[model samples]
Target: MADATADLAGASPAKLTTADGRPLKSALARAQAKARRRAFLLVLPLLLFIVLTFILPIGQMLHRSIFNDGFAANMPQLTQWFVDNPVGTEPDESAYAALAADLKSAAEAKTIGVVGTRVNYEMSGTRSLFTSTGRKAKNFEPPYMQAVLEADDKWADPQLWGTMRQVSDAYTANFFLAAVDLARDTEGKIVQAPEDRRVYVMLFERTFLIAGLITFLCLLLGFPIAHLLATLPLRYSNLLMILVLLPFWTSLLVRTTSWIVLLQGQGVVNNTLVATGILTDDTRIQMIYNQMGTIIAMTHILLPFMILPLYSVMRPIPPSYVRAARSLGASSWTAFRRIYLPQTLPGIGAGALLVFILGVGYYITPALVGGASGQLISNLIAFHMQDSLNWSLAAAIAAVLLAAVLVLYWLYDRLIGIDNLKLG
Candidate 1:
């Protein structure tokens, strides 16, 4: 029995040891190793998913932005016209012949429009250059070149030639510039979009403005609710918390649609206002089809994100902090501001960041409620991708959107770091 007992002791769970068996790892090290493994396992799925869905698509789109060569690839015979130049500043006669041949062939093949449109995506006048030249050129030689020069003194413009030289690739920054409401002139100078078409810049400004407003509303409204949740009795707090979460249980589309029905001209809100005599029967407030509707709907959808984070941070703060401040002869507002408000900064930052980021990319709420002026950048992006069939333009806009979001995130991170230092 003693031998068996000794054997069982030897077989019992042994202390984990290093190779030398000198107490292999500290508790922290063991825990860290377990955490590292768990973290890697937990993140692997998300990493793979993002790579497949986001990273790959973004990379593909960016690649397309600079690629511009469907025509050149299909027609190598026209290349002799472009390259036959004598390697001097003046474009040689052979170069002109090559141009005429290429244009004639391109026009005959019914693919002149593709090249023209692609070039026009960068320089608006390019379509005129190609289209007018093709139609007037009875031959690919002097007459066509003369027509091009006569049609626009821009033919004398070497910069337009430079743009033509660059179109052999399938990608160009033209779409990106156009996405931001800028365009390249014949001289290749980037300038503001024409006065008649300055809508894109306004759209970008509106998107940011709406996002900021929604974030502000979220923080202002959510802070008090979160404070109540953190301070109240656990039962009551939990009930309110459940209510905050209840919206998430319903489909997002359903909620947005409901808001539409509730806020529209003849909807519940307008009817109530009219019945209350605040609004005359014929005087309808335009709430549902404007920025107000978007803000209200988005705020409702995103309030939980703000509340939960603020509540989490506030709950850990003990009531004794406020009591201690009060005992020191601080006023009620002073105690709350000095002792309570500072502790909640982290949650405030987290919740604001969450809501702001979500708001920037909002599409459905804005689309359903936003009339022409209320539409955000995302709506235009969708229109370019689906309605306009302009994938390059859509991709360019998406790239800008991603860049803007990253800049905001970086600023948020910097501010959060500073806040932590102040708190510490």
Candidate 2:
């Protein structure tokens, strides 16, 4: 018996083998490794697609926000002068000489316009200053300081010089400052933009305000509809679900245009109200092309986003829990607050986050429906990208918006555990 016990101890579990005479532990590990490899292979294409499409574009946007070489690349002489001199050092004779050389060189190279436009971003009306000066800078005589200043007295303007110093670098945060309705003065001190020039800040505020209001409206409007879908018979629920999802099949333009037609002053809504004596023709509400229009249209469009998440969560909650609470002497509101609402919290959080994000980033809806006051930050970003042709400023604004969204996301994660979010 002692010999047998010793034999059993020597025959350890690690030494065990499978029926096929393979080591059991190694065989199980090999199977697990193969399964992991298969799973990775299944997801590889999605990983590549995300990196190529999403990650690369965001990386490019961040790079573009701080980089613009138009002035530095075209006006090498002036860039070198700025490099040699520290910030706040008054420009001397060599600065003027370098300016003259660069202006003349840029003129000859036909890149003076590029340099001027770069400077023009910081100091308005300087494009013409550079263009007109470039025309005479080529013929400048010695003591180029006097010569260049003589060509254009605007060159003597301290603000103009201050702006040039800031723009001399190929990379700068001036664009970002401008995006936030702030700017660095000639002395390199940050200051608020002039009242008339301040726009982006207000638009950003409006964007967030509208996004929050829309999310609230969606939650109010969507909650009951989701409950109906969750509690109704399967056949009826599926039909109602189709109605909810029908918007996704329709073209966005068609839906937006439909709202325009319905809500416009002379459209069906106003006409009906007038005919019903609810409103006079002259007193027709101005719903389209304003904040009301944006909110109404956006709420309708994003309703499905709220409803779907809610239904996904609410559907799985057994009705008996709330019923059991009621049977135990809980009032209807008490049962709902204690038992039902807590379970729905995950869906509410998910839906609000999704809707708010989509609302903040929405562009085409606001652009088409939003008039002057209704315009969001996205509209301003578009203006910089398409109309003003200041991609750096646009990128800066986008980056700021992205940061705001991230901070909001962080707050949400802190307030409500992100892992609690229900998607299905």
Candidate 3:
């Protein structure tokens, strides 16, 4: 009808006009643009808030992951020396002279700590070497190479020079390499970290492994509960739903600590079994402060996420469909497999993805109950951020985790079609 009207309007000698004698098409276009502008104005505050709180911080994190100028900014002469020389260049007397000048200047300016920290990231224990040397660099005379080496034997190491060269510039991928348990040799070739120091990769693998287990457990434990809730009558379902959501009202710390009280060696679970004569007190099972603890606590916390989505999808599925299949000479299992199960796939996917993502990043519950064995990569990231003050490396680890999540989302979207995801 609209096309026919347009044809008629085109064939007509007189152009279409509004009541105000303006062209109708132009008037409609103007009204649409005005409406769009009004809508944009209405949402402007929300857009600004998201940009400020979410987008900007993520941008800063990405930037920090690649750029750090603590060393280059403070040690100008040494950084200039690095720029002038090639990768394999050996530091001669001139090099030590430049280092001595920078150290003395950095010491006087009180920026020696910053310079030391950047190098310390690459070569641990060099922070004190730089600071201690900086204190005495002012008295160093000609033949400065001898003076510097005499002050600290570490100053003579070629590997230390290679590291200083690496951090000479404001930007580098070394932090990212360190995040994955890799580092560079004195010749600038990348290689695996020492066996004892190869930790980040292992932590990353453990993190995903635990998250996958948590997601599977949540699905396993939640599927029956969700089905029960969906099939039960309204009065009972509401009561059950309140139980499921009750955790959300309580503090997460409280829930985790409560689990600690129940799962510890002498805690409620062990005491109950001992009292019931199921097990002796000396034979109590070790449940807390290990991978099992992390898995159990996380599964309980994330179970509601799985249930709500499954329940939402399941509630709308008509019981008659299953009964009809059963009446059509199919058994209950066969009917569910052929009809009911396929209907809940969206909820399963949504819930699994939600629980997995949350489990991957969980920290507090793991910290309280996980102990040494259950700690995840986030704990290492926190260690870098809080204890070590290595914000650049922390940001790099976070960036890698975010990249992994995006890759998972991409693969899920490719295989299952993201449009099918349904969350309550």
Candidate 4:
């Protein structure tokens, strides 16, 4: 009994060992960790590439939306004065004195124009005020507030003071507010911008409306084509696929130009209609250089994006399912609605998201085809960046657009799941 007890104790759950006498569990864990490290190392270059090329630029743009140092950096004394004072506090002699000194310094440095330009973005017509004031600030003597007001009564405007206070901080939400067509009043209360200046919100709404329309159009047109392709034999489908891919091989400019040629009044379609008595020469359709032109051009360009995804998802679905439903006494329409439609949802989600995202940022097609009435938010972003030279406002607009897209993506992930987003 004593011997048997000792034997059982010795045999009780001996530590696992590998063939080479290393502990098997520990060895397996080490092997797994090494494999993971190797895999990460292999992907390290790709990760770095994405960070540098994509992530860093987006991060920089988002940062620019809230941060501007044009006034704060250039007008240090005045900025400090404003920071020391509470909002709505009437600027006293000391604040005016500080402003005079800063303006003098900025004028000497030839940077007053930059500061003025920054201020003008928030308060129109203030560019000349800063530049003209700075040019004469050198000759101004004591009783600076009275002297400054004498130079320009505009200096005493509470609105200008409020604008200055708002921009005193190196970081502010003013650009974001401006992006959404909101502003801070003299009392520091948020308010809607004046009617004439309230354009950005409308532009954003139009942008989304256009994108949604394009997405709907793509789905409406793409679904039937994809279904046909999937149902057809491989030999015929491959031939049809070439037609779909043909547009992709063509230059985007060329495609847009082609649409212009086809849709313009003097173009082939209208001329043909005129010759065929469908419409008189005076009654040729007004298509190009309008919303209709934008829609048609974008739909053609983005159709392939929709078709490819739907085709990939549909090609795998067996005909047997539909046949089985039919055998079970289900009507053709009922079988498609219940079984086929549900199965294609993943593809629809992927295609719609891809098309919508692309459409929202569409610049070239809209810029060329979309006239003033048809212009989108991207056109305004470009206008600010190049024409208006309001880069900070442009950056702010881009950041807002990016935030909106991310929110939509997050909602999509929560509802449909990112794992379900499949692409060929």
Per-residue accuracy of model 1 over 1-424 as CA lDDT, tens digit each: 9997787578634455556555534755787999999999999999999999988988998876555575465335444434444222455554555666667777787777876776665556677778777675554446555645665556666765656654544556877888788877644578888888776778888998999999999999999998999999999999888999999899999999999999998999999999999998789888887889999999999999888889988898999999999999999999988899988888888788789888989999899988786799999989977885667888788788888988987887776763542211
**lDDT of residue 18 for candidate 2:** 90
Q: Which stretches of candidate 1 lie over 4 Å from their true place?
A: 1-45, 70-113, 123-166, 169-171, 418-424
How many pairs of residues collide in each model? 12, 0, 0, 0
Off by over 4 Å in 2: 1-9, 12-33
Residue range 1-424, candidate 4, lDDT tens digits: 9997787568634465678988777899999999999999999999999999999998888888898899999999998998788886899999999999999999999999999988998899999999999999999889999989999999999899998888888798888999999998877789999999999999999999999999999999999999999999999999999999999888999999998899998999999998999999899998888889999999999999999999999999999999999999999999999989888988999999999999999999999988887799999999998998887889999989988899989999999998788676
Question: What TM-score number comes out for model 4?
Answer: 0.92
Give all candidate RMSDs, comma-separated: 6.2, 2.4, 2.7, 3.2
Candidate with maximal TM-score: 3
| Every candidate's lDDT | 0.77, 0.92, 0.94, 0.92
TM-score of each: 0.78, 0.94, 0.96, 0.92
lDDT of 1 at 396: 80
User: Clashes in model 2: which pairs?
Assistant: none
Error of 3 at 116 (Å): 1.4
Pitting candidate 2 against candidate 3, the one with the higher lDDT is: 3
Question: In candidate 2, what are the lDDT values of residues 138-211, reduced to their tens digit?
Answer: 79989988998788788888888888888888889988999899999988999999899998888899999999
Output the better candidate (3/4) by lDDT: 3
